[model samples]
Target: MASDYWDRYFRRARRMRTSRRRFLLGSATVGIGAAGLGLVGCGDDDEEEPTATSEPGETPDPTATSEPGETPDPTATARPEETPQPTATATEAPPDTSAVPTDGSYYSQVGEPFVGITLDIHRGVSGIAGGVEGSAYSGLIRFDDIPAPTFRGDLARHLPEQPDAVTYIFDLRDDVVWHDKAPTNGRPFTMDDVRWNLDRQLTRTLADGTVADDFTLTNTVFTHIDSLDYVNDETISFTLKQPRGTWLESLAFAGFMDQGVAEQIESDPDVISADRIVGTGGYMFTEFVPDGRRIAERHPNWHLRQAGEEVQYFDALALLDVGADVNAVRIALEQKQVDWIGGRFQRQAYAPEFMQAIQDANSDIERLDVPALNANRALIYSWEIGPFSNPMIRQAFYLALDRQLVLQQDFAGEGRITGPLPWAFTDWALSEEEILQQPGYALNKDDDLQEARQLWEAGGGEDLEDNIELVANEPDAVRLSEWFTAMMNGNLGTDKIEVKGIPGGSILPYLTGEDPIAFLTPVSAWTSPDPRQRLARSYTTAGSINFGKYSNPGMDDLFDQAAATLDRDEAISAMKDIQRLAMTESGAGTILMAAATGRFLKWPYLKMEFNPWRLPVDERSWIDQSDPTFSGRPSL
Candidate 1:
């Protein structure tokens, strides 16, 4: 999601939480005190596994007004009993291996896979709409799959390259076409659409010469575009202001829209509604009910499918909005009302307890642990705010918090405490030896706390216990925040420490809004292999996603140096320099954990590959026909 929309959604969530009186519970139903809610058992293995061929049932109504099918009320409690479940019985059946296809194609027994997701969806924007759009929309180039960081052509015939390292040439696949729907009318996707999208991103201008202010969220990624020239209907070239090592990765954002649709949306802003948000993707927009559900039917003429073959493995894709109520999502999954939960950038949605509950309830539901490259879980400090404004206080705050203990207690030792860059970037990220040299990253918590107390005293030691507040939104985040509060009060001999927990959607604004002291939240880098985009988004002076308002000339200079060079070694060195400056000197923020495992739950009947870089639940997902309970199979 784009940073601005994330802030906007959090603001909305905060309003909803306050208006509905949805405060964090205190030792009520979950059977644990606020501070005692640490990570417990790893998982349960005794539960019965679900059958792959269970009789297929009717999909839950998207427009239903009641519990089993309706959109979850934001004010609903986290108790599982409060949510309704579908009554689908799973009967044991032998697997039908004979029906399995060997050529990478699988038949779907379920007409359309129902996907349960939690995110803020914006119709007009691409990345801003959250995971649903990420799966439904195709990028020019995309990561192959999880664990593999390599990029592959999705819309383009081949990967685009810059011959001169400053001029990029993209070759379009002629077979690609817009969905056979209105506005685009199944028009052949050409270089014109590509160029138009790129130009709009760069200059925010439509083909008819209208300025589109709303479409400028991605301007920073394509700001280097000096000019775009159409070589032919199938080819376009871009001249950049300078060589960018991550330019190809940036082009993925440009592939989200078709030119015809872009022109219509720009002309009549209201036409950008969900149903009219057309794209040359595998699915076409069908119906979207705000805060309810988004429905997309398979585009019959998608280019990826072979001639005379079925276009989509599933007939349609449904994205349910359970808001930030993770319990509601879990209930829907357990009942088989939704096939899978968690999508693009949704790693934090699964708390440790929730994962354990899913394991205990269903054996057929498998949790895939995917590597979170360039994803960091950290407590961000607002340098522009009160006590955090003082560098000494910022450093002291980092030292006071026991990241290792938090990781063990909150994540069950499934994660490693890290520095500025996540550990997944082994090449560019600091090593254990190097990270130990930095303050607040060392293993000895007692020694760090002593130093933190001394520093706190030196920096005009007022009782910060009562003055400062730590905020977090998700269940795990809330636990971490409360843990930090307890550590400060107990270790530092201070009595006043406050911790507030809200919904995940409310976290962004609390951290980014007016004078935020500190917030516990996770930060994810762009899916690009290069670390330049990540650095630019996090530490740069004009960074759109810099929620903490952390700005340092030294850090900005290092980022600029990294982006200005195409030399791989030089860029990596510059990025490392920026990381060191942000973590150590500038005290931009503290990185509590890095590359923590993310769990994805998929039903036994669903067959799909988990793509960490894209949505975990993809639109191209198919059903395993080898399961004897295949519902759509012709009766023999």
Candidate 2:
């Protein structure tokens, strides 16, 4: 049955490829598959061979779980005969609040413990706000004083696990509550809410009566939903049409919605009106000003601690939706308008002079580094349209680019031309040699004007005549775009290629599969250590994260086999094949750079864990006024 399904997918994939490139557009036409939104892709080369599999081995029996107290090797093929304790609840108990820190007594200087960031980077929240109306809010999960493992505790309810690529189970706790006294507050979170939200996307329709387009499914198996059933009110079970190894780790994505909030929205479709929130998280929503900010005070009832001991203190969390602009951030930070800021800010905008001023003024600041699973920034051209639609022209463009030169001149030698996967988190990411060994890898970056000319003539470029329009959003992107334009104009010869600049917001329209001609935006995600989630995200027809819309039958079949093989060795073998497939295309993507978050602080009790997707913050990372790190800072 699975083989038949795989064959059907391949048939469709071949059709998609007949066209040079397929343009993916907004939610209306966006198709993320059943696997949800996990990042996935293969290596940088175009011809890497798939991983080898074992000889006939009896498939593991599905009736038993792993033995408790024994950790299963992710790569081992011998399936365990026993079942571990079934996760009966997704929720854990709240921690004792008597030990928490008093707010006023702690020092306010920015540092690891008491860092402040100026967050002015905001995106307009119009149609994209989900259940939260026109209110624009950037998610923040920072807990300044406490560190990792501890921070992971306060957020026990939200974080799920990745035992394998396929199965994920969450059991709810009954003790958490909302800040407001609304009827919805403190009510046990049920499976109904989970199923409801998932179904909403599955069945989403436009105001015009068309099915709302889902964006994740172009190259993944993710559907808005496959099957969602509640074992009980406190436990929820999700069965995917495909096995997703990285689904659990993908939960770290900050924007993953909340159940209670969604249910409220479903009941009224305008539930965000309340200033208070009703989530079962460690913090209570104290205030929420649409498009401005939302504050979350630590739940005195949060359950978490250091090394099994209950946490000693907790602090409030704030969400500030500053337009995410660099100048705004500098002003906001200098004027003390905000505390911390994250997300892709232009590096040049944050010049040495600005950083020096903050540091010299005794500003409590520290930069952060979190690994993510994103492909390199690329000048993605749609091979289906214009000159790029021609394979030779596409190859000509590659020859025109001196990737090393671009890295040094455009990114200060801080970038790398990576394969499909980001390299920061993994030690064994595909190397240049590995990429070359692959079947479809770019053999070299050398310009072959002869080849370019020959292909140009063959494709009728000599008569049709095509020019490239480059697009970018922020200043850095603009700078990067211009650099590429200059290269194309200078190297591609006369009457061959002209490069023009388009604004950043316009890039999304292109990503939405709009005009056949346009520079695609830099797709980003933190890489997962394991390949299952990454592979699922890359190959599944439903995954939102597969932006290139590349699909292959052979790859899809291998992914399915990998996912179903409960044995670790078999799964890993399947994952390697998936990775090789992603790298082969070496599309318009480029891994420009990995970033670390900068923190300006004073307390030493802060610790953070890299979700690769985003930082996981909660009460566990904050220090109380009771801790010794609370020294006062001089007013600016």
Candidate 3:
């Protein structure tokens, strides 16, 4: 199933590459996924083939060679049969010094890498605002390496392991310290902090009858944790309600806060004001100008830094609020007003002309593009509401959409038409042939529309009000929503569809309400590499982010079984079943297109680590200026 999916995807990718050279050199840039540039392709033919399996207790190296047309299967990585106990140990392996030049002259010319970045702060910074989660904050565990999902100790000393499938123990580094800010006093990070943070999500109410404002609002991911025990200052344990195969992957969402800060917020929720939010990350929050800009300075006491090493490659980080206008963001990058721009700001790939302008404006700029995992544009229906309440109506709406036309007209043929699961889950995602086999996704628009018309007539026809509103938070979403509205009206002959472009803040209230029948939204499941994390959260009856409020007992059972199964192959099979149910059986939501490969425009002088899953480069990136021709000044 997996190999067949890749075969079709790469074949489509090769077709897009015909114009790649022209798109890159000319003023206009192509959207992501245009030429298989974002998708995985075959390697050299002479490379040795990798073993299909690894030794027990060892994960197969993701970098191993593969056949020309095949990519590494993430599921082939080893899974733990039994949970490993917490051990107070640290891997003291030094950073790969071989990558650095021995001359040290590059560091001298660069001075300090002061990178200025701009983002659409409309999502708001996490902890300070109510809506943002892991996307906006650095969690306890993060995907240290991309394409492989290899995790390294971030806040914790090492990755947590299950003693059994039901229990997980986290061994935190004793040296991790809180920022030298108020309330925290630069104290050593402790298990109490982890316990308090976890408890905020698991236990909503305190023994004293006060509410715990978990602040993060990711309690849905922790619903499986039956209880948490503060074993010691350096150890914390989580007892699950049931076995979960993706429990370790779920830890990536466990961003920690000081116990004192958490308790104070529980007492006075207002204590979590923008300026008061605290975390023990590489960067410390300095200032936030709402809807304008936010700033963070390098923390002098980051625990990850090696002895005698520079505290950080960059002295400070800036997050500018460029608003919802993509053109304004482009202008900012061209003028060198911001050193880099990516993340949600670059969610949609640009037109060829826009790309040309950026290249023409600055020769020093470089593009870093990668295919997004678990990120896609989707049409979300309000299952609990009026028109969408009828499954026939929902199915009719799905069939009415011409996905291929939308991909060409709006996306410039840069996106792949996908199902509920994002293309990021390459191993389990259904192939284009398989996706089209599902109702409404077929290539024959005439046949789909004819079926949709029949379904609509059968589902009360004219009695069902065709009048519906589609809301979008971002510019690209608005464009997609507008295109969909036209298609439904023109093709399906439903003239009552309306499109509304609203601020990101207003999205939740609109979707969770009874007014809007459906909305076009950009959804992502990149928090963890595990498919269960997304499957359970987006489809289950009690899913936290199930905005449409979709519910199904059978589907829930499938997700639960997938989560409980420890074997990789079995878990994958279960996840595939969940996708099949969601796409073929439930029809709860329609995935419009897989997320386009993201493009990051950076100055040549900026030296940064690239992670397709992460954007705008994090704090670990540095600036390099060994070349005599380049200067730190803005090129424009």
Question: Which candidate has the top score in TM-score?
Answer: 1
CA error at residue 30 for candidate 1, angstroms: 34
Taking all chains together, each candidate's TM-score versus the true structure is: 0.68, 0.59, 0.67
CA lDDT of every candidate: 0.52, 0.37, 0.51
Q: Per-residue lDDT tens digits of candidate 3, residues 1-636?
A: 323433454444345325212100100001100011011101111011111110000011111112234433545533577544578453344433323422111111101111221121111123221111112233455544433334556666666765676776777777777788888878877766666666655666554676545323233346667887888777778788886666555455456665555556545643323345567766676655544555666667777664333325655656556555668767666654565554322323344455556767776676444444423446777787777778787787777877777556534444467777766456666666788887777787888898888887788746754566676655445455556678877766657667766665565566556574466644543433355655566678887567677888998888777767767677778777777888764456544444443334665545544432333233334554453224544421
RMSD, candidate 2, Å? 15.7
Residue 214, model 3: Cα distance from true site in angstroms: 4.9
Full ranking by lDDT: 1, 3, 2
Q: Write the per-residue lDDT of candidate 1 for residues 278-364, one digit (tens) a residue.
A: 666666767665445666776777766633322256655665555556677777667665666542333223455666678788766
What TM-score does candidate 3 get on C-alpha atoms? 0.67
Clash count, one per candidate: 0, 123, 8
Ranking of candidates on TM-score, top first: 1, 3, 2
Q: Model 2: residues >4 Å from true position, as ranges?
A: 1-180, 185-242, 249-276, 303-313, 320-349, 360-364, 367-376, 432-464, 468-482, 491-495, 503-515, 518-520, 525-551, 558-611, 624-629, 633-636
Model 2 agreement with the true structure over 1-636: per-residue lDDT tens digits: 222322343333344224221111011100001122321112111111111110110010011111114333445453488554697543434443223433322111111111111111111111222211111121111122111111121223432343544444566544433333364544544455445534444455323355544423222323523666667766655566665433332232222234445444434544343332344444555555555555555545443332243332335444455554656665555444443333221111233344455556643443332221232344544444555666665655555555555534433433344555444323335555675454323435343545555555676655653455555444444455456566655555545454444444444555556465544333433322344545355445544444444456676787667655545556655555666655444343222222112222211323322232222343223433332323342222
Q: What is the lDDT of residue 328 in candidate 3?
A: 77
- Which pairs of residues have clashing backbones in candidate 1? none
Whole-structure CA lDDT of model 3 = 0.51
CA shift of 363, model 3, Å: 3.1
